[model samples]
Target: MTSLTPNTVAADAEGLTLIISGDGIGASSMLQWRGVDYPIDWIVDVDGDGGSLGSAIPASALAIDGTFETVLVTVSTGGAASNPLPVTIFGPGVGAAESAVAGAGGTVTASTGRLTATYTRAAGGYGTLTAVDYAFPTDPLLPPNPISPVAFVDLQLLDGVAGDTLVGTFLPPNPILPPNPVLPPNPVLPPSPIRLAYWTGTTWAPVSGSGAVAPTFSFDWATSSASSATVTFDMTSTPQITALGGTVIAFVSAFAFEGFSAPADSDINVAKAGRAVPLGWRILDLGGNPILNLSSSSVDVSSVRIVCESLSGEAEPLDAYAPGSSGLQNLGDGYYQWNWATEKSWAGTCRLVRFDFGDRNPDGSPIYRTAAFQFTR
Candidate 1:
């Protein structure tokens, strides 16, 4: 017995065609078409009907007796019958004319009395199809159901820091349905749910909050409207911000069905309390480890610099220290020491010193002042 691949059936005014395929069928193989045990016709491989895989059997030849919604078609070889496949038979006047049907996320095409639909399933493979019979103006035109995808229009950073709230505005897609004419028309649609995550120097971290609320970000749709929405990321609730080095915060907005949008960063610098204190006369990495300076022959010095300013009285500028500068010397293991003696005026007074090492985080944000050291000589 040969196994057959199921055939797709398409019907028209002329007749029906069973597009069939199978394995292990030779010239002597017998092919039979049947509907409910009523023998329709039999074709031998040597006959022209059975020579090709797709054999077209006319409706008249099948002798379809009466009205039937579905016809079961099967193939048989060596007296062994394959499983029957059902073909949907449209009623007389239905689907007669070329119809254009549009459904959620997809479209349908009907041409020359054949109906075919190209549809994309929504998330989780679920979708709805709405079909209507086309019979001139008598049939009311389907109300316009526009589907607008959710999107962020204006993203700005109102504030960014460990303690302050990160704020921004986004626009959700417009509603598709029409307003109710009887009851009070609700013009503004509710904002879709969203999650806020900021780019840590290393990876994306969710903006989590402390207190009774687990996640700290707040969806402030009340402050928004149909044209736009607002959200706040509470940095104080997220303890991870304390370890972050820079004031620049890059964050992203995400929707369950829409996925993530490109990252929108805060341009304004947010003040971070208790930034790492720079080591007096020393340079350190972001992790608070002293960065030792190696010998000039072994180290590339172009990227390193130190800025010192007197915090007491009027701010006095001290000559910036660099690798080749007389007072700047490299220790070992990425550590460096600045000799205050070179700047005689800067040695005796209280001063604020900042280190600028050519180091960057994985997210491309510059590793700003590892520590701000206040030195009193």
Candidate 2:
């Protein structure tokens, strides 16, 4: 069970902190806010079962300031997602309870045309960068699903403390569309803005109270920087910084993600045991052209584990046959199938097979594609 504290906020609220309390929340649990996923900072784990997750919502509702929207939030961990909670961002307000942050306000820089952008920290609280690694980002169609980002920028900060401050000006990516000096004005919709995010080995995620995965690192983000042509973000050092493997590579808020659609739950349960069942999963991107790698070559068949949940409510993983090497077939189009060597001992028990294609939500939540079977033996 999971719940949010003070689940209501002012429509124009800034610097609001939300607390999530739940049982069985894994240390790696992440929060799904609106269409974006956030990392949860655990305050305490009561006997490793329940605790309050932390997150900072500088702007209420959606990331954009002044946007009035009722946000549905959830926390996911231990292969399970908590129930949805609606945190209403209330009122059409003119209240200014929040004050501006006067940090080391730094300098001006620019981002050019490229997918991977880089920033170098200067002496003062300023830095400069240029980037634009164009990616066709998408949102995962899995539990606690989030929306896709229209345009994303792959940003990397160089130099330790000073550089990460992100206190500087940013110019638009270069090669700007040639202006039709002769043409008249045309009403055009703008692409969705990308949020400040980091790589989680699976997907791009926003930096929040939650910790970073894979590299096992952390960074201080000034959630107030508006993604405008000229933007300045105030950042500082945190106690969670790790020197090695801690190089922070930030990406725009996530969207257009990988969706696991294969090995439907209905296709798993059976009336018998000891049968070779086809248990596997399929991964898909928004468009055929994905920003992340989703292919057979990327998965290691040797890491497959068959977990058993006995009638006594006990669950553990066994070193089962590798799904790809034994009776497994590459079905193409991200479909990898494997024959389950069901054991007679599994009678009257539930069997689980999990596959982590290294795909995660923008909030750093791994999309664990799993298959399960029930034995009536």
Candidate 3:
């Protein structure tokens, strides 16, 4: 719908086309909005009799300005007779913004924009055509209906222009919800029914929607003196799938650390270390599939680093590495991500496959980092 309000004066000048269909040999009638009638326009095959009113006018020409409201058309089936079906015709002036027309097998051409409308009376006296707005439904921060089935929830943040900052805490139902006076002086916005959480720099806030009721949210912030801190929220616990948009990983400090070397010396005293046997080296031929399982039997290593080369042409690597006896690491886990980055530059060719691994031995010993796997496209 246009942003203009009702009662706004509209204009019209151009003519309009009204198409009407006939059944058998019948006389069709035309009527004006309040009740004026006109002879149904007819077509004649010069060779045939002008008997009874032939087929209804294939197309009728009418002078219509945008402001014209309604007109009417009626079909008269004679002799072996049928009821006079009244067809309502609307011009742009009626404010009928959308309409549909039967195309093939009872289907319709979707309605769009301001235009003329023609409704055909069906066999059962029902109007086969209906009109509705063409605009798409919006996803607002709040919802008219409210219900919470699960303890955890996802809230949407209000979208804003670049450089805009959401400084205060957002209230439930409305972003302008009153704050809990008992807590420190925190500016708050009302809550929304759509419970998607958003970040307002220092903390997370819920986006509000229509009919959303006010609810309390616990706030938590994680930070460390190290260059970066890894927060582990279970994938099954939260709804996020990819590491992008609205979410972030923060690095508190910036420092360059020394790069370690691959293992070189083969022999060592009994107390120093055990022999390093080459672990299983294999190709990750299947790209784009989930990493279902990873199995390996090795002689000596504190940690193992795996890299999917760009050739893997896969989506982001699934977090599949295990740290010590922690079992399987959750996908998107940073332990495997950080270690692999330190071990190798892993990027696969666009349409090719690749793989590599590193044995990160403990006690500052030289760990053996393997070569990247090469493969055909």
> What's the lDDT for all of these models?
0.30, 0.40, 0.24
How far in Å is the alpha carbon of 172 misplaced in model 1? 22
Per-model TM-score, in order, reads 0.22, 0.30, 0.20
What digit string (tens of lDDT, one per residue) describes model 3 on residues 97-160?
Answer: 3222231223222232311123222223222232221111211321221111111112111111
Q: How many steric overlaps are in each model, in order?
A: 12, 19, 38
Rank the models by TM-score, top first.
2, 1, 3
Better of 1 and 2 by TM-score: 2
Give the Cα error of residue 22 in candidate 1, in Å: 1.6
**Tens digit of lDDT per residue, candidate 1, span 20-113?**
5566444444445554332223334634555445445666543332221234455656667664443433333232222221223432332221
The prediction achieving the highest lDDT against the true structure is 2
Evaluate model 3: give its TM-score: 0.20
- Give the winner by TM-score: 2
For model 1, the stretches where C-alpha displacement exceeds 4 angstroms are: 1-12, 30-32, 36-51, 61-68, 92-377
Off by over 4 Å in 2: 1-144, 147-264, 288-297, 300-328, 361-366
Candidate 2 lDDT: 0.40
